[model samples]
Target chain A: MDELMEVLRRALPKVNWETDQALVDDGIIDSMDVVSVISEITDEYDIEIPSEEMEPENFNSVQAIYEMIQRLTEE
Target chain B: MQSIVEAVAAHARALPEKFCIADSRRELSYRGYWECISGYAAHLRDLGVGVGDRVVVRNGQNLDTVTAGLAIQLLGAVFVPVEKNAADTRILEIIEAVEACCYIAAKPMELSCPWEKLGDVLSFRDESADFETFPYPGGADTAEILFTTGTTGKSKGIELTHRNVVAVAENVIDGVEMKKDNVEVIPVPLSHSHGLRRYYGNMLNGSSVIILDGVIFYKKLFERMETFHATAMDLVPTALSALFRLSGDRLGDYRDQLEYVQLGSAPIPQQDREHLCRLLPNTRLYNFYGTTESGCSCILDFNAMKDKKNCIGRPTCNAHFIFTDEEGQKIEATEERPGFLACAGDMNMKGYYQSPQLNAETIRNGYIQTKDLSYMGEDGLIYMLGRQDDVIVTGGSKVAPDEIEDAAMQFPGIADCGCIPVDHPLLGKEPKLFVSMERGAAFDPAAIFQFLKDRLEAYKVPKQIEQMDEIPRTYNGKLQRKKLLELEAARAAERSES
Candidate 1:
């Protein structure tokens, strides 16, 4: 989860990841952005972000993204 | 001579039973349409409306607004249609600018200065025999005053004469091959040129017209089209984008019945066009380019889609175009140089209502100088390059935001994006990119920045990327760059406070 937060901080430094819930709702990370981030996470952690796992809830925050990555890689 | 009343009368004489207009409430035949128009004309005459007078029409997309527009023309009064329940400021501005003799509201309500509810103002108690007859006003008489979007600044009332309106309708019919059997479903706002022209074009040919109030109801719109067996339809790019995103099965069903689709107001993206073609192979797609000042400048047919997707095609019949540089010197069609587009034709409006300064700036000699930038292709087709006002100047080099936005939309995970010029003390003005992503997508700012860096010049790449839920849009669905700038400014202020 800390690794995911670090990655998000590098990607979007302007956003206050702690309080700004708009990361997803405000269309900041659009579909293409999500796809790009999934690929980046896959490349970084050597874990694939499957199409089925792509959901808004799974990408709500840095912690969620990290946990999802861990679960996919472990499986 | 080219008044809408005369046009309707001729059609009524030939095909009284033909479908003229189909609204949410009712469908009126040719004879019924003429009778209603005559009834409304008599009501206007009773209110002392005559040639050179203006009648403000405040109504949603209903049968009343259509008939009221025809009636205004029949009575030789300029029809000034403001959107129903518009802001008091906008309504007052329109009423005052046009010097409207009487304002007609769709619902029953008293308004300031000679305003009356349409229902109360016009009597519909079968007074057909007692209705007064209004003769058609000759050409050169003002027919309507349509307010421009005012995106550049203040909204200006564009005065379109009877000849101008009729000529545009004729040109559009000729260009698109609109027939009497054609049923045009209009989904744009009645206050804008797209809706008004589509309605009038069908009426001119005695073709059927269907009016849909709210355009966001795509499912309902598709159902209504199927129920009515509509042949043709007019829409803006935003509506087309929504329709493009629908499931293939649903799109297939609608495509099977549709004859042709027309898009205007903004340029339709190439991806949307290809998607539409794949879904509706038989239906012809046309992109119409025009402004409130110059009605319909050009019509890009489906065939032109092959060579260049963004080409707005050539000028319609009875219209001539010229490309002028910043120094106002005419430039020939070339690969590198793009210039401001100007047009001279019968479809062009007389001038802005009561604004000589705006009139002088826009209309010169015989041409209406369109502020849009475009370059002509070898095929003689015009390719629009974003608006001149929206051009971003950074480090003495001019960059169009559309090119950057277009490139960004192609990038994976980027749902939509807009580029705006942010104030930079050193560079004077720098480009800033604001992007929106689809739900559930993870975004990497570094990856996006790198992707854009590879695709665009160093200066063109946004110095900062701001993620947004949705890009702000104008009422017509065009990108609201000015509002986006405001959003960026507000964010900067918040950051400074912190």
Candidate 2:
């Protein structure tokens, strides 16, 4: 998860994704950021994220995203 | 002939408890919405924002933005809606340019101008306030001053009249076949002309709107649609594409629920149009063609014209066109030799705010000369060839960027691409291409060039192709050519320094 955050931070240096729970809801990150995160995770995780898992909840918080990555990796 | 304020008041009287609008925090019924408008009208009056005054409002999409905009119009003040997320200097520049009487923002900002936070005064609702008592403005009165996306130059504020707004409302309503029972979830920015016009039409039709912050919250947009039983929504093409790419076929689940989908402020590629038609077979897909200066005059129902390519449909009942040659003479354009597409109608803006030179250049013979070069096809529909201003002349040959970009889209390994003009030593100007590669795809420009060379004309072929992390686009989806040029200049400077 820490490794994933490092990848995310490269895209958005300003955001404190670790502490921000409402990233999408608060408009802290937008569609562009969402695209970068998806692109980064695709390369870093070597796992394709299914379309159903692209909802706001999965990307709204650091913990939520970490869990999603864990769940996908395990599967 | 009834004004929008009168129409809303009628809705308030007839369907007081009907859902009118909702932001992230609060929901308002028709009656409640009226109360907010009335209260805010009085509050703005108290602050000396009266008839014919200009108020600069830089606020995000929220309840205050919704009501205060109407309230400003209620008091006969011009509503100047700039992007809330715009730089403070730009916001201040607009305030100075408009010579605004007051500035309103969603949050506190350090500025020397007379300003008020949005919720501070606009939220002061007196229970006894009545919208019925307000003096109505004339049809010719300027209601809004919306800024253009400024893709090519400095953003100019377009001054739209009350008549124009009403005409646009009717056009969109007729174009999309909007219904009173419709619950439309609005993810488009309320501050933009497209969303503002949508809101006006929905209000006139007594339709409900769930104003989610942005379309980035696709989950909320879809969730609200399901929860409210929403039958409609609006999006720009790029945002729609982003959602389409991110979610894949999840949008297919709500096919039956969605009656119509509106795409405005940008063009929809033929591929997406066909895909959406297949995905939502029952849905009415509308591709809008208009600008801040002309409102939404041409709307193509892709569902109706499934076979037509590059068609933006005939002008609406209120709008008519005046195509002119390069010499400003009206000419009948052919498919091969297209004329400059110009618009003239009740929906056209009065003029740009304080831009005499631009007004003179743009507004000629009662028509606004659009950047688009188009021709009327044999089917008696308008077909845009490309932007007249955006055309690149390579070795004395006029090249449309759309042709190049469209060809590039068909090439594999390229996720996104745009064609912009760059300087050439011999030709003076040449076409330059930028592409963003798909994940794990190789940036093999030579192969892509070979592919595009076979597809495009010799002069139309880009002189240089560069790979970018992303092709920067304006919020509403127009290519940010200036940003790309700036980046190129910065790169050159870095190279020189190294």
Candidate 3:
């Protein structure tokens, strides 16, 4: 999860991650970015992010994306 | 009251034998054109179309379409012309939104409005022309309801009054220095301000208008231009670029005959303008800067292109422009800093029909906030940056898409490009470029990246590049960036699953 946050911080430095919701609503982190993020997450953590778990709501927030990666790895 | 009607009657009386509109099929003189419009006007009145009634006209660009427009105006009713080739859903949406009483379609088609065959309307050869003149609603009455894609969200009706239309026509004539003998080949969509203004402008000047079937077929367009001996023509950037590339040699044949080539609607790329000037050295090129809201704002002449390059030229007569900040305060022309472009003019539209929210956001006091960012140089020419909404901010740095796209297009093999923002974990956002290449050309993404890197700043370089078969465009040939973004998102999702 820390690794995921680190990668996210590198990719989106300007985003506060704690306060901003512009990623999903304003079409900043669209579905393509979701796939790329999931792929990068799996490679870094050595775990797979299932297709069903790729909903926009789950990956909308930084914390949510990290949690999803943890759940997928544990499963 | 009758003076407005007299304007049309005066044109008919003055130039009865003069060619009014010519299409592929036939040519109609001013006298014949008025007679047809009079018949259609009588037909519309019999069908209960009175003042303020919205009439939807759907037909290809032909003499009949021009007649339909004149007929609507002659009867003092609002003309809402839907693009003939518009998607059925889009057409229905417009009809439903406008609440049109009668729709004049070229053929029997399913539409929300009661579709009437154009043949049936025109076939009523009532030679007993009583010419029942209705009380002409001067400047205030809605002349046309032009539907422009709403920047606010949904498509809204732009209510243009008779005064607005006439003001625009006069502005085009004065700004372009249109002569009475200048024959203009109008190939733009009649639904748009470009087409309507050109048609009426030619009529106002007693000049001939050669209406092509549509603007899509470049070969046919050249043929028609030569056939009619067209001296002037108006084109959007895409059509102009396509014609420039397709008719490179053929254009030379008519180079001497052609007088002026007017471009508007979208930004004319610097390279494309240079190529056009090179091809037709004798012809003058003009770029018009205006919107459906304000009819004619600036006219960038051929000479201005050499020095100002992308500048939209000075404001036209009867129009004034000012750059405003976010807070609506005026910004002075200085060495640095560009501001939002605003217009104060007679050619401005009345307001969005039944849209108080949009009216409030767009028009404040007497000025229309164009939402287009621009700066005035020392030469007093206004250079438009891009739309305010099109600006992308990544890693605290704001980026304009036009600068990136313009730089990218300068590279070989690239035809058209659109830059959209993609979410980045560290950067907050990064530009994802979508490019369309010229036919029979192979694109190397690395070469493009290297080219962009050489031309632009490191931060402005596109993080990702996607090649598309063709760029999606609106009916008027303006790039649909939002649609491209959607396609990019969908493609990304599909790739993830694979």
Off by over 4 Å in 3: A1-75, B1-6, B110-113, B120-122, B125-135, B149-152, B215-220, B302-304, B333-335, B393-398, B423-430, B457-459, B487-498
Arrange candidates by DockQ, descending. 2, 1, 3
TM-score of chain A of each: 0.75, 0.91, 0.74
Interface RMSD in angstroms for candidate 3: 18.7
lDDT of 3 by residue, B300-366 (tens): 8864467664477878876788889998899884425678898887788899988899799998778
Instruction: Give the range where candidate 1 chain B is weakest over 10 consecutive residues by summed lDDT.
Output: B121-130
* Fraction of real interface contacts that model 3 preserves: 0.00
What's model 3's TM-score? Answer: 0.79
Name the best candidate (by lDDT). Answer: 2
C-alpha lDDT (0 to 100) for residue B358 of candidate 1 = 78
Q: Tell me how each candidate scores on DockQ against the true complex.
A: 0.02, 0.29, 0.01
**lDDT (tens digit, per residue) of candidate 1 on B1-498:** 386668888887788888887765467778887777787777778878888888888755667777788788878888989875366678888887777788887443344558666644225422352223566788899989998767668988889998999888876787678977998888777888888887778777778889876443455566668767899989888767755553334666767677788888875555666667777788878878888788777888763376674467877886889988876668884546678888999999888888889788887778888777888888778887667888888988778888788777777778778899988898889888888987677677788889889988998988788898888877667788888888878988999999
- Model 2 chain B: lowest-lDDT 10 consecutive positions: B118-127
lDDT for B134 in candidate 1 is 61
